[model samples]
Target: MDEQLMLVENLDMCFSTGKGNITALHNLSFDVKKGEFLAIVGPSGCGKSTLINILAGILRPTGGKVVLDGEEVREISPKMGMVFQKYAAFPWMTVRQNISYGPRIARKPKSEIEKITNHYSSMVGLEAYEHLYPKELSGGMSKRVDIARAYANQPEVLLMDEPFGALDDITKKQMQTELLNIWGQENKTVIFITHDLEEAIFLADRILVLRRPKEDQNSLNFIQPVPFSRPREPELRTCGEFVRLKAELSEVMLK
Candidate 1:
């Protein structure tokens, strides 16, 4: 597989508050290829979102660099679609309207917008709900809408910051399975952040583990080549290899 994206060399992040200077990320580095699912896991405030924010161009790093398709990340665009922990769907808009927003903002023609919206709504299994408003949707329905809108824009990279974090366990699992199905069809490069070990193991082609320091420092422990096969089977979670990998990550994360 060719490398479509990478964070080459050392990457750093810092912030200055009223008290003093703070460094959120230190020497962060990783590489991802096309159609790969990469998951980043760490303790809360260990700079998971900080790293993501930097990648999204929402927050520029204080030092180092990021290389996307051999270029620096200068701005955010539909080329990268972000899904947050909360369903950031517009409650006032119908599902179709919400999905059409991105294409419209890009000044796409009405004919093109309709084509993409209908395609994405069906892709996310939300075709029947396109006319429904957010208030009429269930927890699962709302999340599907958010996902539909994100993918409709035809992003090359999908950045999900614990999208299932707000869902019930059962619903979360169902969404995970649904996501894999959608991904199989779309094949976009994915970077997903999750605190759940099982979630990382289940979804990632490889996992990047972030470390938190007792004295308030940040570091990384890279463990690649994780054997998470595509089209995952529910029974795989019970397999010894799967449990062992999950256990190994737990041991490192605890300190």
Candidate 2:
């Protein structure tokens, strides 16, 4: 079997509010296999975002480690790329420029930058939009740019935080199909964090659940596995197997 691409072990994340320190995740652990599509879901304030941040090395964990490949990284590794919940595209830059921003910042060879940006623009279906600015684009269009920018870096591990949160239902579903196409084409390890169970079920090979921080009582701890088949169809949602799996996961989510 292929090796795991990322591993989060005994994770503990806490935030310091004016009130005091609030523990967000307690002893959370999981592994993401290479080329696998993983999703993390939980109630609000369950530290799911924090966990993603830690894995991206954007935020430091109070305890535990995010090991990629065979080693732990002290800073954000260049091999990891991210798409935030909100669109993080640069309004001043054209679509191509935004997608090429990372390579530009790294001072890559001009020839290489052009080659990569052109390829990514076509890959994300934004070739025509390359010359356009973000403000000229729709909300969904901005996200497409964001995804293109991240993938243009050719990162082996991708971290997406509710990338479809802002789109309308129709646009959101379209984006999902687009993302699956991209994932299928690249076959990289992907970790998607979201609250939408249906979305998770459709896209994830495995699902991780982070228990809510319960001040009133101790939090539940565990990651749930999703055994649905790939190239999931709409009818899968109505199938007896899918129905029972979703109902079970929903029970855990409501807890």
Candidate 3:
């Protein structure tokens, strides 16, 4: 079995609104193993993005702790990288410059930045478009650049918050395949957030279902393992087992 990479214990988040305090997450807990792909699914207002933000150290939990490789996470760490739903490419920067941004910010040598940029640009199939700016790219191409930029940072864990939610179905499927291909090569631990049940089943090693907190319930409803063998092909989405799992998760989500 793979070693545990992260542990979230009794996590909670609350916001101060004029309507008074709103609790976004309530006593959420889970663990992610090294190199595992874990997908989080929940309805709107169930705190999925809030959980991702807390995990990224972008937001501090009101209670509980996030332990990464044994140490408690109090602030952002280079071991984690995020890809947002919005394709957050810098409009002024070319593809090469965007992908190399992290390394450059860390003051890596020019030679090393060039090597890292070239490697990841090719990894996401964006090598030929290295000179292109964000406006020149299509939706799918822009997302590829986002993935490349995140991975170029060489994070131990990658957090994606509905990164393909903006794409059409066909493009979303294509990007899923592209992402899996890159993930296979790198084997970095991934925590993916999505509302699409099929998308969750298709990509994750395990699926975490978070329920909207009620008077008597905790935020984490349950965790389900994906039984499908990986190197998952696009056609796997149509398989009987995949369909069954999707249906099961859909039911869970609707509850």
> Mind giving the per-residue lDDT tens digits that candidate 1 earns over 105-174?
8999989999999998988888888899999998888999888888888787889999999899999989
- Candidate 1 global Cα RMSD: 1.9
Query: What tens-digit string does per-residue lDDT give for candidate 3 at 33-109?
Result: 99999999998899998898899898999999999989898888888898999989999999888999899999999
- How much lDDT does each candidate structure score? 0.84, 0.83, 0.91
Query: Candidates' TM-scores?
Result: 0.93, 0.91, 0.97
Better of 1 and 3 by lDDT: 3
The worst-scoring run of ten residues by lDDT in candidate 3 lies at: 212-221
Instruction: List all candidate RMSDs to the true structure.
Output: 1.9, 2.3, 1.2
Residue pairs in clash, model 1? none
For model 2, the stretches where C-alpha displacement exceeds 4 angstroms are: 213-220
Residue 57, model 2: lDDT of 90
Clashing pairs in 2: none
Q: CA shift at 132, candidate 2, in angstroms?
A: 0.4
* Residue 113 of model 2, lDDT score: 99
Off by over 4 Å in 3: none
lDDT of 1 at 27: 80
User: TM-score: which is higher, 2 or 3?
Assistant: 3
